[model samples]
Target: MKIASLLLFFVLGAVALPAAAQSVAEQQDAIVIENLRSAGSDITKPHSIDFFLYFPRKGQAKAAATEILELGYTVVELEKSPERSEWSVHATRTLVPELETMKASTRELEKLATEHGGAYDGWGTSIVK
Candidate 1:
């Protein structure tokens, strides 16, 4: 009986760890999706979601933009910060704002940004009326 209990504990711990390892940005995606639903946005319908990526250099930002554009995101803007030295690329894609989909996209964007010496700063969308 003790051996069975120990096995169950390890199994549950392994299963729970992944959920607990969710990034803060992913968690915020869930909250924002819920808020959009509450605000009468049909989350199942496609919406224009904007993602922001920041880099220390303009070249890095432009490189990231080209890559994301190839990945099907529209390059909305690429500009340097007026107050700070960082450069930013604003990319948008139209997709259903489902939590899982948004989270997966966030992970991919984050990885892409990291590869380009930048960081994905998260995403936003206007409530679809």
Candidate 2:
């Protein structure tokens, strides 16, 4: 009877693992879709545009934002929070091609954030053309 119970427990654990994984994946996908939808609705431009966003820190968020600018998007710095000691910068650039490339990159970043289940403190966008 003990051996039978042990086998049952192992089988249940195996089944539970896959279900948990699928739930996480679904949640991630939902977040990605929501982000993309919101971004699409918020940006409209007749020219190319780019953006940079700064979070609570001056390191990773800043660097990631700069990297977006380097990808051929005009950078606009939105807000710098000096009072909080951490810069909350949001930059925008105009994109001539309507920001298809920028959207793809941002989507990838969002997915990474979701999978990791960490806070995404910064967000920016490229100008729509």
Candidate 3:
């Protein structure tokens, strides 16, 4: 009975981990969207959204940039930070910053970063006039 209980716990944990992570990401997306709306930015119009990612190694950053480029994002800049000693990749894509769209893009970019031994820092954009 104890072994069975432990197995159930492990199974539940494994399933919940992804959902938990996604929930956090969705919450962040909502907050950013709300902030943008409050700032008088037109979320319905396509805006140049910038995504930030970081990798510990230059090779991983380069590989991630290639992948992001394939996803239709312009690789704006890829450089190593002298102070932080991490490779940073700034990519931009023009899209309407809807909540669902932002969430989906965040998930895809997060997955790509993870696969390339890096971290998807977050995203930002200027208020379109």
Candidate 4:
């Protein structure tokens, strides 16, 4: 009887999962795609970037820092949290002249961090005061 009940529960869960997935797919299909840029080119770009990342511990945070530098990004400054579990790194990449290209490179950085099993917090690029 116990085995039968477990089997029935599994069967019901399996039946419900497909319906949920289909609903999600339908919702996804309803989204409207928008183009970010519609012009030929843009002349404005940030000269530098500042990235701040928080991690579970210092070792992991340091590893991420090293990874970014390995990719040829110049490390402007690095400061670890007093608890030694987080880090704030400010780095600058030479302007690529195209804003879209710069955004794509940053997306690659995000993928690199995820590949190392770490989460990326956030980053910002603008003229320094």
Candidate 2 Cα deviation (angstroms), residue 115: 11
Candidate 3 lDDT over 1-129, as tens digits, reads 999999999999999886576756666888888899999998899999999999999999999999999999999999997667899999999999998899999989999999999998889999875
RMSD of each: 1.9, 8.9, 5.9, 11.3
Question: In what order do the candidates fall by lDDT, top score first?
Answer: 1, 3, 4, 2
For TM-score, the strongest prediction is 1
**Residue 42 CA displacement from its true place in model 1, Å:** 1.2
Model 3 earns a TM-score of 0.81
Provide the overall lDDT of each model, using Cα atoms, as 2-decimal numbers.
0.92, 0.47, 0.90, 0.54
Counting clashing residue pairs in each candidate, in order, gives 0, 17, 0, 0
* Model 1 agreement with the true structure over 1-129: per-residue lDDT tens digits: 999999999999999897789987888888889999999998989999999889999999999999999999999999997766899899999999998899999998998999999988899899887
lDDT, candidate 3, equals 0.90
RMSD of 3: 5.9
Q: What is the lDDT of residue 112 in candidate 4?
A: 60
Mark the 10 consecutive residues where model 3 has the least summed lDDT.
Answer: 18-27
For model 2, state the Cα shift of residue 1 in Å. 44
lDDT by residue (tens digit), candidate 4, 6-83 = 999999999988557542222222221111122322235344545555556556666777888887777676676676
